[model samples]
Target: MGSLGQHGSKGEIELRWYQGSFYWSRYKLILMNVRFESKSDIRPETLLVELMNFTMKETNYKRLCSTKTVSAVNDNFLGPTILVHKWDTFFANIHDRGKYGITIHWHGIRQLRNPWSDGLEKIMKCPVPSNTSFTQEIIFFIEEGTLWWHAHSDWSCTTIHGAIIILPALRTTYSFPKHYAEETIVPAKCYKGDVMTIIDEALTTGGDPKISDACTINGQPENLYDCSNIWNYISSTS
Candidate 1:
């Protein structure tokens, strides 16, 4: 999640965001293999622009000989900054390997005259192990657009994948409407039966769940100001 800049031999990046009342610094993010569950069950509005995150492993070509633990920090998310260093890479599993070794593929990028930098089987090397690690360098010169990163070694592909969006250069500016609306995100789960599951569970407990029957905005518990899990309102249609 570092910035994208010319840092001589090393690549350092930064990103920033405007919170409320003041500007807040957004940190670069690194995520492990965690299940991304959709509680709300609704695909929120996806904006035309996007952001991306990249992870590193010990067995990567660059880190193979090192003995250190890596962790993400705030500095990685800073915008108008350097996002990654040249030659930065990650290891991913192939189609259906036993998770023994992993492969690294740089999507939407061409390794400047270096085919070795291209992460492909039979052409390059085997996959990197889990406990062990590998080193990969970011290859610049790739155009910016809707892109993604994924595993190319084994079944690990199902989990070890993330987005890769290159932002517009600072020199350029994009136009937008003046009456833009802010976005809101919620978390929840929905099955084939809808909210009825709550009622069923309540009935199974020998009591009325007290859920509403129509579209509800923000509900409260016993007290209107309780602001807890109280069922406020319900929606007639989904």
Candidate 2:
């Protein structure tokens, strides 16, 4: 139910496969909150996402080439996109494997009567310490449409964030006309260095963090990063 293979009969299976292609982590239904509705005995989908250190390859811009060491979820800068239905409950088992602490926050998700997963970090919940894991229960009862999930601890959100797509509940139909396909485009600023270090240096010096170098669409800087391209590398497959 993400950017591709989101319709027809095999869409669901394809999406799950896409999740599998990202990181081979163990996941299963662990707990069930009775308040969450049971449609066809729906159970929680446990997602085990790991936070670790890695290096991203050359994102050459103009005459510059770079290989930046950074921290990410499942070795990806843009973390995993969570696909779920309205009124469905899922668990995010976040394991922090980095040097510092971290926590995840689901943006635009309505956690009514369940504030534990709100992910306020120091305000509501503490950060998941390094080498430890924390399980967050997410139940969306009323909210829908394209949302996001990001790191709630310190400056981690700059590198750890992903999409959250909430579809219509079971036996429910969209009030408006439905499209045959969908696309998820994230318009963001492209930075060439370690964002966590950028912020940490800024905090220590009381200076503003590094300004974004390029504006990107779907994580690509288009011709802004490379000089020998016309339309970047975005392709459409039918």
**Top-lDDT candidate index:** 2
Whole-model lDDT values for every prediction: 0.34, 0.60
Compared to the true structure, candidate 1 yields what TM-score? 0.35
Error of 1 at 198 (Å): 36
Off by over 4 Å in 2: 1-64, 227-233, 236-238
Per-residue CA lDDT of model 2 for 1-238, tens digit only, reads 2221223343231223246644212111111222333334242232122222322221223311445555677766456677776766667877777777777788888676668878879876898887777787787667678898878877667667778887776666677898898877666566777667778899999999989876665445656566423254355422
Per-residue lDDT tens digits for candidate 1, residues 86-192, read 22333222232222455556557665544554666456766555445455544443345434444554323322344454443333333454444322111211111
After the best TM-score superposition of candidate 1, give how far the Cα of residue 125 lies from its true spot, in angstroms. 2.6
Best by TM-score: 2
lDDT for predicted candidate 2 compared with the true structure: 0.60
